[model samples]
Target: MQLVAPLNSSLRRVPPGWVYLAGLIPLAWVIWLTVSGGIGIDPVKEIEHRLGKIALWFLIGGLAITPLRRIAGLNLIRYRRAVGLIAFFYIVLHMLAWIILDMGLLWEQAVRDLIKRSYLYFGMTGAVLLLPLALTSNNASVRRLGRNWRRLHWLVYPAVGFGVLHYLWQMKVITPEGWLWAGVFAGLMALRFRPFRG
Candidate 1:
Protein backbone atom coordinates (compact mmCIF):
# COMPACT_ATOMS: atom_id res chain seq x y z
CA MET A 1 0.00 0.00 0.00
CA GLN A 2 2.91 2.35 0.75
CA LEU A 3 4.30 1.98 -2.77
CA VAL A 4 0.86 2.55 -4.25
CA ALA A 5 0.46 5.64 -2.07
CA PRO A 6 3.00 7.60 -4.09
CA LEU A 7 1.30 6.67 -7.38
CA ASN A 8 -2.10 7.55 -5.96
CA SER A 9 -0.76 10.91 -4.80
CA SER A 10 0.45 11.63 -8.32
CA LEU A 11 -2.95 10.56 -9.74
CA ARG A 12 -4.66 13.03 -7.44
CA ARG A 13 -2.59 15.80 -8.96
CA VAL A 14 -3.90 14.82 -12.42
CA PRO A 15 -7.20 16.29 -13.55
CA PRO A 16 -10.16 14.22 -14.76
CA GLY A 17 -9.95 16.10 -18.03
CA TRP A 18 -6.97 13.96 -18.93
CA VAL A 19 -9.13 10.84 -18.78
CA TYR A 20 -11.76 12.43 -20.98
CA LEU A 21 -9.14 13.43 -23.55
CA ALA A 22 -7.57 9.97 -23.52
CA GLY A 23 -10.99 8.41 -24.14
CA LEU A 24 -11.31 10.27 -27.46
CA ILE A 25 -8.17 8.67 -28.83
CA PRO A 26 -9.89 5.30 -29.21
CA LEU A 27 -12.85 6.84 -31.04
CA ALA A 28 -10.46 8.52 -33.44
CA TRP A 29 -8.56 5.27 -33.92
CA VAL A 30 -11.76 3.43 -34.72
CA ILE A 31 -12.75 6.13 -37.19
CA TRP A 32 -9.43 6.07 -38.90
CA LEU A 33 -9.56 2.30 -39.25
CA THR A 34 -13.01 2.40 -40.79
CA VAL A 35 -12.06 5.22 -43.16
CA SER A 36 -8.94 3.43 -44.31
CA GLY A 37 -10.90 0.24 -45.06
CA GLY A 38 -8.95 -1.43 -42.33
CA ILE A 39 -11.94 -2.41 -40.21
CA GLY A 40 -12.63 -5.65 -42.09
CA ILE A 41 -15.28 -6.31 -44.77
CA ASP A 42 -18.25 -5.34 -42.63
CA PRO A 43 -17.15 -1.85 -41.69
CA VAL A 44 -20.43 -0.88 -40.04
CA LYS A 45 -20.43 -3.94 -37.82
CA GLU A 46 -16.76 -3.45 -37.09
CA ILE A 47 -17.24 0.15 -35.98
CA GLU A 48 -20.32 -0.77 -33.96
CA HIS A 49 -18.56 -3.63 -32.26
CA ARG A 50 -15.47 -1.54 -31.59
CA LEU A 51 -17.48 1.29 -30.06
CA GLY A 52 -19.57 -1.05 -27.93
CA LYS A 53 -16.48 -2.88 -26.75
CA ILE A 54 -14.89 0.43 -25.78
CA ALA A 55 -18.04 1.35 -23.90
CA LEU A 56 -18.05 -1.98 -22.08
CA TRP A 57 -14.42 -1.49 -21.05
CA PHE A 58 -15.16 1.97 -19.72
CA LEU A 59 -18.26 0.69 -17.96
CA ILE A 60 -16.27 -2.01 -16.25
CA GLY A 61 -13.52 0.48 -15.42
CA GLY A 62 -16.11 2.72 -13.80
CA LEU A 63 -17.47 -0.19 -11.78
CA ALA A 64 -14.00 -1.14 -10.57
CA ILE A 65 -13.32 2.23 -8.91
CA THR A 66 -14.71 1.47 -5.45
CA PRO A 67 -13.02 -1.92 -5.18
CA LEU A 68 -9.75 -0.47 -6.46
CA ARG A 69 -9.84 2.21 -3.79
CA ARG A 70 -10.81 -0.14 -0.95
CA ILE A 71 -8.56 -3.06 -1.83
CA ALA A 72 -5.65 -1.53 -3.73
CA GLY A 73 -5.66 1.88 -2.03
CA LEU A 74 -6.00 3.58 -5.40
CA ASN A 75 -8.33 6.55 -5.75
CA LEU A 76 -10.04 7.58 -9.01
CA ILE A 77 -13.23 8.92 -7.47
CA ARG A 78 -13.04 12.18 -9.39
CA TYR A 79 -12.87 10.51 -12.81
CA ARG A 80 -15.75 8.07 -12.43
CA ARG A 81 -18.23 10.53 -13.88
CA ALA A 82 -16.03 11.16 -16.89
CA VAL A 83 -15.54 7.44 -17.37
CA GLY A 84 -19.30 6.83 -17.15
CA LEU A 85 -20.23 9.63 -19.53
CA ILE A 86 -17.65 8.47 -22.06
CA ALA A 87 -19.07 4.97 -21.78
CA PHE A 88 -22.49 6.39 -22.53
CA PHE A 89 -21.09 8.34 -25.48
CA TYR A 90 -19.73 5.20 -27.09
CA ILE A 91 -22.94 3.36 -26.30
CA VAL A 92 -24.95 6.01 -28.11
CA LEU A 93 -22.61 5.88 -31.09
CA HIS A 94 -22.81 2.12 -31.16
CA MET A 95 -26.60 2.24 -31.22
CA LEU A 96 -26.64 4.93 -33.88
CA ALA A 97 -24.30 2.92 -36.09
CA TRP A 98 -26.60 -0.06 -35.79
CA ILE A 99 -29.64 2.03 -36.58
CA ILE A 100 -28.40 4.31 -39.32
CA LEU A 101 -25.64 2.31 -40.99
CA ASP A 102 -26.52 -1.29 -40.29
CA MET A 103 -30.25 -0.99 -40.45
CA GLY A 104 -30.17 1.83 -42.98
CA LEU A 105 -32.64 3.73 -40.80
CA LEU A 106 -35.28 1.23 -41.79
CA TRP A 107 -37.64 1.24 -38.89
CA GLU A 108 -39.34 -1.94 -39.98
CA GLN A 109 -36.13 -3.90 -40.35
CA ALA A 110 -34.73 -2.52 -37.12
CA VAL A 111 -37.89 -3.45 -35.26
CA ARG A 112 -37.83 -6.93 -36.75
CA ASP A 113 -34.21 -7.41 -35.77
CA LEU A 114 -34.87 -6.04 -32.29
CA ILE A 115 -37.72 -8.52 -31.88
CA LYS A 116 -35.85 -11.45 -33.33
CA ARG A 117 -32.62 -10.82 -31.43
CA SER A 118 -32.96 -11.28 -27.68
CA TYR A 119 -29.47 -9.93 -27.04
CA LEU A 120 -30.58 -6.59 -28.47
CA TYR A 121 -33.07 -6.27 -25.64
CA PHE A 122 -30.31 -6.63 -23.07
CA GLY A 123 -28.24 -3.97 -24.82
CA MET A 124 -31.17 -1.60 -25.20
CA THR A 125 -32.25 -2.11 -21.60
CA GLY A 126 -28.76 -1.26 -20.39
CA ALA A 127 -28.68 1.89 -22.51
CA VAL A 128 -32.12 2.99 -21.34
CA LEU A 129 -31.10 2.50 -17.71
CA LEU A 130 -28.00 4.64 -18.26
CA LEU A 131 -29.94 7.55 -19.78
CA PRO A 132 -31.19 8.95 -16.49
CA LEU A 133 -27.79 8.61 -14.87
CA ALA A 134 -26.15 10.59 -17.69
CA LEU A 135 -28.81 13.28 -17.58
CA THR A 136 -28.31 13.88 -13.85
CA SER A 137 -24.52 13.70 -13.90
CA ASN A 138 -24.11 17.47 -13.70
CA ASN A 139 -23.25 19.41 -10.54
CA ALA A 140 -26.50 21.31 -10.67
CA SER A 141 -28.49 18.12 -10.86
CA VAL A 142 -26.45 16.64 -8.03
CA ARG A 143 -27.45 19.57 -5.84
CA ARG A 144 -31.05 19.48 -7.02
CA LEU A 145 -31.59 15.76 -6.55
CA GLY A 146 -29.91 15.56 -3.15
CA ARG A 147 -30.31 12.09 -1.59
CA ASN A 148 -32.26 10.82 -4.58
CA TRP A 149 -29.21 11.40 -6.73
CA ARG A 150 -27.39 8.52 -5.12
CA ARG A 151 -30.45 6.34 -5.40
CA LEU A 152 -30.78 7.14 -9.09
CA HIS A 153 -27.10 6.44 -9.71
CA TRP A 154 -27.52 2.97 -8.26
CA LEU A 155 -29.15 2.17 -11.63
CA VAL A 156 -25.60 1.74 -12.91
CA TYR A 157 -25.22 -1.65 -11.22
CA PRO A 158 -28.13 -3.18 -13.12
CA ALA A 159 -27.08 -1.38 -16.28
CA VAL A 160 -23.64 -2.94 -16.02
CA GLY A 161 -25.09 -6.38 -15.35
CA PHE A 162 -27.31 -6.09 -18.39
CA GLY A 163 -24.35 -4.89 -20.40
CA VAL A 164 -22.27 -7.89 -19.39
CA LEU A 165 -25.05 -10.27 -20.32
CA HIS A 166 -25.56 -8.41 -23.58
CA TYR A 167 -21.92 -8.87 -24.47
CA LEU A 168 -21.80 -12.54 -23.50
CA TRP A 169 -25.10 -13.58 -25.04
CA GLN A 170 -24.40 -11.85 -28.34
CA MET A 171 -21.37 -14.04 -28.88
CA LYS A 172 -22.11 -17.56 -30.14
CA VAL A 173 -19.26 -18.84 -28.02
CA ILE A 174 -18.06 -16.76 -25.12
CA THR A 175 -14.31 -16.20 -25.32
CA PRO A 176 -11.86 -16.40 -22.45
CA GLU A 177 -11.84 -12.60 -22.33
CA GLY A 178 -15.62 -12.55 -21.95
CA TRP A 179 -15.45 -15.07 -19.13
CA LEU A 180 -12.71 -13.01 -17.50
CA TRP A 181 -14.93 -9.93 -17.63
CA ALA A 182 -17.73 -11.90 -16.02
CA GLY A 183 -15.40 -12.96 -13.24
CA VAL A 184 -14.28 -9.38 -12.75
CA PHE A 185 -17.89 -8.22 -12.60
CA ALA A 186 -18.74 -10.87 -10.02
CA GLY A 187 -15.70 -9.94 -7.95
CA LEU A 188 -16.52 -6.24 -8.02
CA MET A 189 -20.13 -6.88 -7.05
CA ALA A 190 -19.04 -9.13 -4.24
CA LEU A 191 -16.70 -6.50 -2.86
CA ARG A 192 -19.69 -4.22 -2.46
CA PHE A 193 -21.16 -6.64 0.09
CA ARG A 194 -19.79 -6.43 3.64
CA PRO A 195 -20.03 -10.21 4.10
CA PHE A 196 -17.97 -10.95 1.00
CA ARG A 197 -15.33 -8.41 1.94
CA GLY A 198 -15.08 -9.95 5.39
Candidate 2:
Protein backbone atom coordinates (compact mmCIF):
# COMPACT_ATOMS: atom_id res chain seq x y z
CA MET A 1 0.00 0.00 0.00
CA GLN A 2 2.80 2.42 0.83
CA LEU A 3 4.52 1.54 -2.44
CA VAL A 4 1.34 2.31 -4.35
CA ALA A 5 1.10 5.82 -2.90
CA PRO A 6 4.35 7.00 -4.47
CA LEU A 7 3.45 5.22 -7.68
CA ASN A 8 0.18 7.12 -7.71
CA SER A 9 2.04 10.45 -7.65
CA SER A 10 4.24 9.44 -10.55
CA LEU A 11 1.20 8.24 -12.41
CA ARG A 12 -0.55 11.58 -11.99
CA ARG A 13 2.21 13.40 -13.82
CA VAL A 14 2.33 10.91 -16.68
CA PRO A 15 -0.70 8.65 -16.65
CA PRO A 16 -1.22 7.20 -20.10
CA GLY A 17 0.88 4.13 -19.39
CA TRP A 18 -0.72 3.72 -16.00
CA VAL A 19 -4.17 4.10 -17.50
CA TYR A 20 -3.42 1.42 -20.06
CA LEU A 21 -1.97 -0.77 -17.34
CA ALA A 22 -4.96 -0.23 -15.11
CA GLY A 23 -7.37 -1.13 -17.92
CA LEU A 24 -5.30 -4.03 -19.23
CA ILE A 25 -5.52 -6.04 -16.04
CA PRO A 26 -9.28 -6.45 -16.17
CA LEU A 27 -9.25 -6.93 -19.95
CA ALA A 28 -6.60 -9.60 -19.66
CA TRP A 29 -8.50 -11.23 -16.83
CA VAL A 30 -11.57 -11.44 -18.99
CA ILE A 31 -9.59 -12.94 -21.84
CA TRP A 32 -8.01 -15.42 -19.49
CA LEU A 33 -11.34 -16.53 -18.10
CA THR A 34 -12.75 -16.97 -21.57
CA VAL A 35 -9.77 -19.06 -22.59
CA SER A 36 -9.77 -21.11 -19.41
CA GLY A 37 -13.43 -22.00 -19.56
CA GLY A 38 -14.03 -20.38 -16.20
CA ILE A 39 -16.77 -18.13 -17.52
CA GLY A 40 -19.29 -21.00 -17.29
CA ILE A 41 -21.94 -20.15 -19.89
CA ASP A 42 -22.07 -17.88 -22.92
CA PRO A 43 -18.51 -16.66 -22.64
CA VAL A 44 -18.66 -14.49 -25.71
CA LYS A 45 -21.67 -12.50 -24.58
CA GLU A 46 -20.29 -12.21 -21.08
CA ILE A 47 -16.97 -10.90 -22.35
CA GLU A 48 -18.65 -8.49 -24.73
CA HIS A 49 -20.89 -7.15 -21.98
CA ARG A 50 -18.05 -6.73 -19.52
CA LEU A 51 -15.83 -4.97 -22.07
CA GLY A 52 -18.63 -2.64 -23.11
CA LYS A 53 -19.37 -1.71 -19.49
CA ILE A 54 -15.70 -1.11 -18.75
CA ALA A 55 -15.42 1.06 -21.84
CA LEU A 56 -18.39 3.12 -20.73
CA TRP A 57 -16.95 3.39 -17.25
CA PHE A 58 -13.72 4.74 -18.73
CA LEU A 59 -15.66 7.21 -20.84
CA ILE A 60 -17.46 8.47 -17.73
CA GLY A 61 -14.22 8.51 -15.79
CA GLY A 62 -12.58 10.59 -18.50
CA LEU A 63 -15.47 13.01 -18.35
CA ALA A 64 -15.27 13.15 -14.56
CA ILE A 65 -11.72 14.53 -14.61
CA THR A 66 -12.67 18.19 -14.95
CA PRO A 67 -15.30 18.02 -12.22
CA LEU A 68 -13.16 15.98 -9.85
CA ARG A 69 -10.25 18.34 -10.25
CA ARG A 70 -12.47 21.36 -9.66
CA ILE A 71 -14.71 19.98 -6.95
CA ALA A 72 -12.56 17.31 -5.31
CA GLY A 73 -9.10 18.86 -5.88
CA LEU A 74 -7.69 15.90 -7.75
CA ASN A 75 -5.29 16.53 -10.66
CA LEU A 76 -6.92 14.11 -13.04
CA ILE A 77 -6.32 16.12 -16.18
CA ARG A 78 -3.11 14.37 -17.20
CA TYR A 79 -4.94 11.10 -17.75
CA ARG A 80 -7.87 12.51 -19.66
CA ARG A 81 -6.54 11.71 -23.12
CA ALA A 82 -5.47 8.25 -22.13
CA VAL A 83 -8.81 7.59 -20.55
CA GLY A 84 -10.61 8.84 -23.62
CA LEU A 85 -8.49 6.82 -26.02
CA ILE A 86 -8.90 3.65 -24.01
CA ALA A 87 -12.59 4.25 -23.85
CA PHE A 88 -12.60 4.61 -27.62
CA PHE A 89 -10.53 1.46 -28.08
CA TYR A 90 -12.84 -0.62 -25.92
CA ILE A 91 -15.90 0.73 -27.63
CA VAL A 92 -14.35 -0.28 -30.94
CA LEU A 93 -13.90 -3.78 -29.60
CA HIS A 94 -17.47 -3.84 -28.40
CA MET A 95 -18.63 -2.66 -31.81
CA LEU A 96 -16.58 -5.30 -33.53
CA ALA A 97 -17.96 -7.96 -31.26
CA TRP A 98 -21.45 -6.94 -32.16
CA ILE A 99 -20.57 -6.83 -35.83
CA ILE A 100 -18.56 -10.02 -36.10
CA LEU A 101 -19.75 -12.12 -33.21
CA ASP A 102 -23.33 -11.04 -32.90
CA MET A 103 -24.00 -10.09 -36.46
CA GLY A 104 -21.46 -12.38 -38.09
CA LEU A 105 -20.46 -9.63 -40.49
CA LEU A 106 -23.92 -9.63 -41.93
CA TRP A 107 -24.61 -6.16 -43.26
CA GLU A 108 -28.35 -6.70 -43.24
CA GLN A 109 -28.38 -7.79 -39.63
CA ALA A 110 -26.17 -4.87 -38.61
CA VAL A 111 -28.35 -2.41 -40.48
CA ARG A 112 -31.46 -3.95 -39.04
CA ASP A 113 -30.12 -3.79 -35.50
CA LEU A 114 -29.13 -0.15 -35.93
CA ILE A 115 -32.48 0.78 -37.39
CA LYS A 116 -34.72 -1.34 -35.18
CA ARG A 117 -33.01 -1.25 -31.81
CA SER A 118 -32.87 2.09 -30.06
CA TYR A 119 -30.09 0.80 -27.84
CA LEU A 120 -27.89 -0.28 -30.71
CA TYR A 121 -28.46 2.93 -32.56
CA PHE A 122 -27.48 4.93 -29.50
CA GLY A 123 -24.36 2.86 -28.96
CA MET A 124 -23.43 3.08 -32.62
CA THR A 125 -23.92 6.81 -32.60
CA GLY A 126 -21.65 7.17 -29.60
CA ALA A 127 -19.01 5.05 -31.25
CA VAL A 128 -19.22 7.01 -34.46
CA LEU A 129 -18.63 10.30 -32.64
CA LEU A 130 -15.57 8.90 -30.90
CA LEU A 131 -13.87 8.21 -34.23
CA PRO A 132 -13.12 11.85 -34.99
CA LEU A 133 -12.07 12.55 -31.42
CA ALA A 134 -9.73 9.58 -31.44
CA LEU A 135 -8.28 10.46 -34.79
CA THR A 136 -7.49 14.02 -33.76
CA SER A 137 -6.14 13.18 -30.32
CA ASN A 138 -2.48 12.96 -31.28
CA ASN A 139 0.02 15.80 -31.06
CA ALA A 140 0.17 16.20 -34.82
CA SER A 141 -3.55 16.49 -35.23
CA VAL A 142 -3.80 18.78 -32.23
CA ARG A 143 -1.28 21.11 -33.84
CA ARG A 144 -2.92 20.81 -37.23
CA LEU A 145 -6.40 21.66 -36.09
CA GLY A 146 -5.64 24.11 -33.28
CA ARG A 147 -8.89 25.48 -31.81
CA ASN A 148 -11.01 23.39 -34.14
CA TRP A 149 -9.76 20.27 -32.38
CA ARG A 150 -11.13 21.47 -29.08
CA ARG A 151 -14.48 22.14 -30.68
CA LEU A 152 -14.58 18.61 -32.04
CA HIS A 153 -13.59 17.13 -28.71
CA TRP A 154 -16.43 18.88 -26.95
CA LEU A 155 -18.70 16.44 -28.73
CA VAL A 156 -17.71 14.02 -26.00
CA TYR A 157 -20.53 15.29 -23.83
CA PRO A 158 -23.22 14.28 -26.28
CA ALA A 159 -21.40 11.06 -27.04
CA VAL A 160 -21.53 10.27 -23.36
CA GLY A 161 -25.21 11.01 -23.32
CA PHE A 162 -25.71 8.63 -26.18
CA GLY A 163 -23.74 5.97 -24.33
CA VAL A 164 -25.76 6.37 -21.15
CA LEU A 165 -28.96 6.30 -23.14
CA HIS A 166 -27.79 3.15 -24.84
CA TYR A 167 -27.29 1.44 -21.51
CA LEU A 168 -30.62 2.58 -20.13
CA TRP A 169 -32.41 1.55 -23.27
CA GLN A 170 -30.68 -1.83 -23.33
CA MET A 171 -31.88 -2.80 -19.90
CA LYS A 172 -35.30 -4.33 -19.87
CA VAL A 173 -36.04 -3.60 -16.22
CA ILE A 174 -34.07 -0.34 -15.69
CA THR A 175 -32.41 -1.60 -12.52
CA PRO A 176 -31.06 0.56 -9.73
CA GLU A 177 -27.57 0.12 -11.18
CA GLY A 178 -28.67 1.62 -14.47
CA TRP A 179 -30.28 4.51 -12.65
CA LEU A 180 -27.10 5.09 -10.65
CA TRP A 181 -25.04 5.34 -13.84
CA ALA A 182 -27.54 7.72 -15.38
CA GLY A 183 -27.60 9.78 -12.20
CA VAL A 184 -23.83 10.08 -12.15
CA PHE A 185 -23.76 11.12 -15.79
CA ALA A 186 -26.47 13.65 -15.05
CA GLY A 187 -24.37 15.05 -12.24
CA LEU A 188 -21.34 15.21 -14.49
CA MET A 189 -23.27 17.06 -17.16
CA ALA A 190 -24.69 19.41 -14.57
CA LEU A 191 -21.21 20.15 -13.24
CA ARG A 192 -20.27 21.69 -16.55
CA PHE A 193 -22.10 24.74 -15.25
CA ARG A 194 -20.03 26.82 -12.83
CA PRO A 195 -22.93 27.18 -10.42
CA PHE A 196 -23.24 23.44 -10.02
CA ARG A 197 -19.53 22.68 -9.81
CA GLY A 198 -19.02 25.26 -7.13
The C-alpha lDDT values of all candidates are 0.94, 0.86
Clashes of 1: 0
- Model 2 scores a TM of 0.90
> What's the C-alpha lDDT at position 148 in model 2?
95
Q: Which residue window of length 10 is worst by lDDT in model 1?
A: 189-198
For model 2, residues 32-96, the per-residue Cα lDDT tens digits are 99889997698768877888998998999999988876765666677889899999988988888
Model 1 residue runs over 4 Å out of place are none
Residue pairs clashing in model 2 are none
Cα-based RMSD of the predictions, in order? 1.1, 2.9
How do the residues 1-198 of candidate 1 rate in per-residue lDDT, one tens digit apiece? 988899888998899999999999999999899888899988888998999999999999999998888788889999999999999999999999999999999999999999999999999999999999999999999999999999999999999999999999999999999999899998888888989674
- As for model 2, its CA RMSD to the true structure in angstroms is 2.9
Superposition error at 85 for model 1 (Å): 0.4
Candidate 1: deviation at residue 176, Å?
A: 1.8
